[model samples]
Target: MTTPLKLTEEYIFAHDLREASAKIYRASTKALLKHFRTTPIEEIDHRAVLAWRKKILENGLSKRSWNTYSNHLRTVWGYAIEHGLMTHTTINPFRKTSVVPPKRASKTINGEAIQRARNWLTSLVGQERCTQERTQITPAWFWLAVFEMFYYTGIRLNALLCLRYKDIDWDNKMILVRGETEKTHREFFLPIMEGLAPHLCRILGEAEKIGFSPDDQLFNVNRFSRHYHGKEMNIDQVESIYRKLTDKIGVRMTPHRFRHTLATDLMKQPERNIHLTKSLLNHSNIATTMNYIEVDYDHMRAVLHERSLAQGALSRVRRVDSSGTPPTSAITAPSAQIRLPSRKIADPKPTTLQPPQQQAAIEEVIIDRPSRSSGPSALRKALEFASAQLHSGSMESATDSPSDQIDQNLLLTLMASGLGVGTFRKRTQSERSMGSTSFSRASP
Candidate 1:
């Protein structure tokens, strides 16, 4: 029999994180209960509580929000038991309940798309329309700068927004952020990307022009929301500026798109160090980093190319070959498995005379062969070389003699181009799977 005013005030004093807890409690017991037939706290059972949670979750509430609600209710129920307001037999509904939140859907952004977004941002600066007046100096620059900072540092949006001038070290290309702004509440200095140095420098220059102290915020952003007095920037404001520029410049983009794009972009370079990438992304585990990264498209393409070359699927018919003078449309490429009896040329052959040039072509010349070693060092070097060429898109000359084993790229390529491999005997099996689209538009 508690009134909303008395219950809210009394409960808030007992809870440590009073503000957010009170909001959640009011939403659950007051707002939510109004929607249901169940009237009193004593009458509300575990099933009823779970049903409320299910309603909120099905309405697309975040896990963070759910946790807040559950924690608040747990506290309130505990308070009741502690004061003997309810019997001990009156079970706490949410105590052992496991909330298995649905996995959040992710969006994909490729390198080409990221570049287009960046280009639009650059175009936003220094433009004029209609009369002789300069174009609107909106938050596009701030959003772009923020986006570049987000991807380049892999810092959280909250952390990046809170960055002060003193936090950055331009000479070392590093920034020191507070732990409070971070998701983990453990701040680490991150290096700014060299590619984005110029843009960041421009921001610093503007801050300097405005005579900002090291302690002050680097930019006067956030006028889009919160501050009703004059201005204060927020997420929607940042996105609105970005969206306007994107629509005008014809680049499909959003802030989170930059983060996803960086993950994919880093995977593009085979020489990319995973350790460096993990550190940059500030991920706790290597597995989490792997989830965001994708297989390099260039690597896949090279594998396809190798298969095409190996399978003799393609031939370059030059103008001379195409001419009707006395030509074959195709010059046969080599098959890796052209076996012959081990009869040496030096074993004596019944020779017939041929043209000097034709005789030169027929003759086998082994010129200046390198000495081979059986040591581990030599074996290691050979393995390294093979791995480098295979991964780095360097293929052995097609005209060169076939080795004991084919390159793995050539193997993957051949498989894609209809080669029967060891396990995936069906050709073009893997090539058909060009990844999946992450999001789909729902009808409005």
Candidate 2:
């Protein structure tokens, strides 16, 4: 019977996973086999897997770390069942396991931390320039450029370390992240930020002076190595230097923190769109990019408060009136105490009250005429026509008709009320006070 370890080896060879992925899976599988203690492939049941999980957790393995191992075991078992190495009736033990990974802690580096890293790098470059007897530049300049690229491009540390001079487009100011080198396994281009361009140029100058060619890696481990033989710095050595610098500066950080810092800083721009920030970070899912952004609730509340203040100001402007009272047109009239203009029409002509005997005679003459259903409106129109005639200094045709009588009646009725006859009739207070004598005399 084929053992679990041999089946796992077959699966690894068949899948042809990338070098980094294969390495991780092989390590995960090796640890699992070590725990199995010569158990057959088909006999490792869910109970055994559970016990193994407990053992690892007891040994200080986090749930997330154990999940990685369980995930690899599941993949290998899937391959075994497919290839007939294990019976199809057997259930995969890893399928029955549950491991909820903990929430990711914030890896964001602040501006002060970035500045300190840059200052440390700058001091290193100065030290190298002063103490080094050789004319060629030291590794400090290369490390500075590496950190600057990390801040600007937000590429993974491995991708940045592996960048070749040919990957950069000098004229176009863009850098190509090869698909093979990227964690996503897909190629993409990133624009060279203007701030990082000078550092890149300086590195290139130093590389050229040291007999480097266009095909050579942008940053090599030549100066750091005792033999001075140019070799690409592995990820571990790069991380070691980063750790030392951060520890010395008292700003504890990792290289990956720069990626978080870039994403967060870009998203904070007032004019930045969320999708644009996602693309800048090269994130496949916008939710992943969002995890890096820390919104300021206090700032948002302040903006909303300012908006409300502006709206209140506009409401006050609408409430202003010439009389210093609230406008009647406001949304809530009761609150503002606005008064509407009176609707009762004033009489069109003014005169003193006539005596009972004379008033009765005038009413009989006007009321005895054939009454129209539109009484007040017809009388009002007749008064308006006569007033217009008086103002223009014109008279109607000489023919005496019923229409003329109606106009005369309207004038008499208006005179009985208290109103002026348009602009044509103007009487002084003395004339008005003289009562019927002056009023009759003034009438043409």
**By TM-score, who's the top model here?**
2
The lowest-lDDT stretch of 10 consecutive residues in candidate 1 is 435-444
lDDT of 2 by residue, 1-444 (tens): 677668778887996466788777888888887888788766678888999999989999989889888888788887787777787446777896868878877677878878887887788788878887432224677778878888888888777777887888879999988777766777788898888999889877776677676677776766343535646767776787778777777876777888887777786678758788777777788988888786656667978988977766433344345655543332222112222322221332332222232222222223223233445666566556544434332233334432223334445545444333321222323233432111121111
lDDT accuracy of residue 363 in candidate 1: 21
Residues 413-437, candidate 1: write the lDDT tens digits: 4323332222211112111342211
TM-score of 1: 0.51
Q: What lDDT score belongs to each candidate, Candidate 1 first? A: 0.54, 0.65
Q: RMSD for each model, in Å, please? A: 18.4, 15.0
Alpha carbon deviation, residue 177, candidate 2 (Å): 1.2
Which 10 consecutive positions of candidate 2 have the poorest summed lDDT? 435-444
